[model samples]
Target chain A: AQRVTQPEKLLSVFKGAPVELKCNYSYSGSPELFWYVQYSRQRLQLLLRHISRESIKGFTADLNKGETSFHLKKPFAQEEDSAMYYCALPPFLNAGNNRKLIWGLGTSLAVNP
Target chain B: NAGVTQTPKFRILKIGQSMTLQCTQDMNHNYMYWYRQDPGMGLKLIYYSVGAGITDKGEVPNGYNVSRSTTEDFPLRLELAAPSQTSVYFCASSYSLGGNEKLFFGSGTQLSVL
Candidate 1:
């Protein structure tokens, strides 16, 4: 019953404008969340993790427990920032203690000049 | 460092045919994973290995098999290929466990089943 939802499949913004990509999750316990970005023809890579509390590529995400949300935000958008972004939670823990990763559908962010 | 490598950048297989998707990592990561990405579906875990000779199924393991005979290699096998199996397969590796671990992914393999 653990799920991560990225409501926006695509979002567009002008350069220098602020942008936010929403992510929400459903879990019973404290959750660790991460933001991953995939550029055109490039491999997926970790952009940031809620635990690090550090901004990467001018992007930051704050994990809100009450609303069960971890939204990625940037103060100013850049054309190079345009890509597919996904929110993820480590997969559910099984009896054997093995866990996989759960990924959201992802949001395509377009930063237009 | 070739963090993770997946062979057969693209492939076309007919129904009932079989093929193996190769993956290798040079980072000496103990945790390796296989995932299939579909349009609008994100990435779904197919299988994973915690270490050599330790393999387990993920959310979507059906129609796929994996072997982790060495720490640097993890190959996914697809037997009796079907239309549903067509997807972009990605291999990843992480050095640690828990949510803090950062996963490094390969370029990915685009597979098509006719």
Candidate 2:
């Protein structure tokens, strides 16, 4: 069974502080992990993906195979960075040809000034 | 581009009532999916379509149905609406299943069942 877990429901940090949102996954094969963010009044959009190894909006996530974790991190928290973040894994080679995504419960990050 | 559009931004339904949530995409994406976001819970896949006239059940497909009559439209139908079904529903589309492809989501439809 493939599963994604986001242990933190809410993570609050002061502006200029470092932020980290934990995400872990259980899968037998190579996994593709993604971080998605939904800001107020905006559609949910991709923040970053492990495959690209690229940072977006000053946020970067590194997939740790040994730990089975892909934690999202930012050097300095910004008020605009507060949003609902979700960690997701793409469906890989399911039996029915139906590709579905397994997602984490999501973490609400609050950056207070 | 009005990438992915979901109608009825908010809805209220009674138990046992049936309603359809409409979703349309103009990006010509071959893949479309419906997911529900519950409080403190991750989004759960309800149904997905690979292309026109091709639909399949997802992780949680019970009490729901979907139809993809064309590349641009994929609608989710809720039969016998239950309180447990009250959640924010999102419609998403992707160009493919590969790792490089990113999903584009709609603003979402918040449904409340009384």
Task: Please report the TM-score between candidate 1 and the true structure.
Answer: 0.95
The best candidate by DockQ is 1
lDDT of 1: 0.92
Q: How much of the real interface does each model capture, measured as fnat?
A: 0.64, 0.67
Which pairs of residues have clashing backbones in candidate 1? A91-A100
Candidate 1 regions off by >4 Å? A91-97
Which 10 residues in a row give candidate 1 chain A its minimum summed lDDT? A91-100
lDDT of 2 by residue, B51-73 (tens): 99999888789999999989999
> What C-alpha lDDT do the candidate models reach, one value each?
0.92, 0.91
Q: Give candidate 2 misplaced runs (Cα > 4 Å).
A: A94-98, B98-100
